[model samples]
Target: MTNNVVIPSRCWCGKGILTYVSKTEENPYRRFFRCEIGLKKKKEQHLFKWVDEALLDEIQRMHE
Candidate 1:
């Protein structure tokens, strides 16, 4: 069974590429990524967090 996974993607800010930082167990160990550029800007710059599934549900509902 594969344990570690690498997600190749860019940040929302279009600043720098993001990499998997850590994993959480809120819902079966979800992977989290963060923007390197945004991290250097501020501690709470809103770039170092995982995309929550709840947000996706809300977005899908909005389009329907």
Candidate 2:
């Protein structure tokens, strides 16, 4: 069997999983990722990434 390293999509904090949220007003229907612990600490800097941006980055990496 071939060995393959697996990578996680969650935050490095190990507190919660990545959550998908849809922006409905300013950026209607745009999807983004956030950590589940956002509700507990409003000021905490958690994972916040845009789905489109992440996809674009991945595509770029594949071509490199």
Candidate 3:
């Protein structure tokens, strides 16, 4: 038996894990999470979320 509790930090692509990276431009110094393969130049659904924004959305949902 395996416990498959999907972590909130994982990418939708089951294969790739989300990683944190600091933004270099735009919102410089801000951190975000994305699928490790997001760096690849391919047309696929990848996870790219700002840490702050994601947290806010979750909080909002909780309050609702």
Candidate 4:
């Protein structure tokens, strides 16, 4: 069984609003997030990626 986790709509930089960009097909299956307001500033652009289920589960099992 699998579940779709809803990524929160908050930026890591404490910005209130964030936007979804795209998902990567890499081993960790990155789901990208971009800060809406931070993008305006060339240096302050904030983007992050959340790993998908498979990689997360693997890591969890390793620690067990």
Candidate 5:
């Protein structure tokens, strides 16, 4: 999905994006972006992206 990666500022539901650190053992302290509303609701699909991956994608795009 490299071609589709983009930094998201807003969710499809119009809510603001929020950055949060992962608490899971698999990715402790890893930062990610998610839709604020979806994070609370937990029943619908929403925007979720890894900050590092997004930045990498952006950098790759710049080089390209």
Candidate 6:
């Protein structure tokens, strides 16, 4: 999928985004943005983006 990262300010559910570090073995210590409500209800569509990917998108935008 194309990178549409833009440092999301909010989720479609109208809640503020939260930054959290991953504690799983697959993605240990990786930071990501997520909607608080989505964390409670795992089986729902919500905003979730990687901090590093978002920053990379920002840098790419600057060059373009």
Clashes of each: 0, 0, 0, 0, 0, 0
Output the number of the TM-score-best candidate. 6
Runs of candidate 4 exceeding 4 Å displacement = 1-9, 22-31, 45-47, 50-64
Model 4 alpha-carbon miss at residue 61, Å: 9.3
Summed over model 6, clashes come to: 0
Better of 4 and 5 by TM-score: 5
- Candidate models: Cα lDDT each: 0.52, 0.63, 0.64, 0.53, 0.89, 0.92
* Residue 37 in candidate 2, Cα distance off native in Å: 0.5
Q: What is the C-alpha RMSD of each candidate to the true structure, in Å?
A: 10.0, 6.6, 6.6, 7.9, 1.5, 1.7
TM-score of 6: 0.90
| lDDT-superior candidate, 2 or 3 | 3
For residues 1-64, write the lDDT of model 6, one tens digit per residue.
3566488999999999999999999999999999999999999999999999898888888888
Error of 5 at 11 (Å): 0.7
Q: Once superposed on the true structure, which residue ranges of model 6 sit more than 4 Å away at CA? A: 1-5
lDDT string, candidate 4, 1-64, tens digits? 2342334466667776554445444534344445666667758756443435435755666676
lDDT of 2 at 55: 69
Candidate 5 lDDT, tens digit per residue, 1-64?
3657489999988999999999999999999999998888888999999999999988888888
- Top lDDT hit: 6
With a 3 Å backbone cut-off (N, CA, C), the pairs that clash in candidate 4 are none
Give me the displacement of residue 24 in model 2, in angstroms.
Answer: 4.8
Which stretches of candidate 3 lie above 4 Å from their native place? Answer: 1-7
Q: By TM-score, how accurate is candidate 5? A: 0.89
Q: What is the lDDT of residue 16 in candidate 4?
A: 62
lDDT of 2 by residue, 7-63 (tens): 226765776556466866777788776677864677988767777777676666667
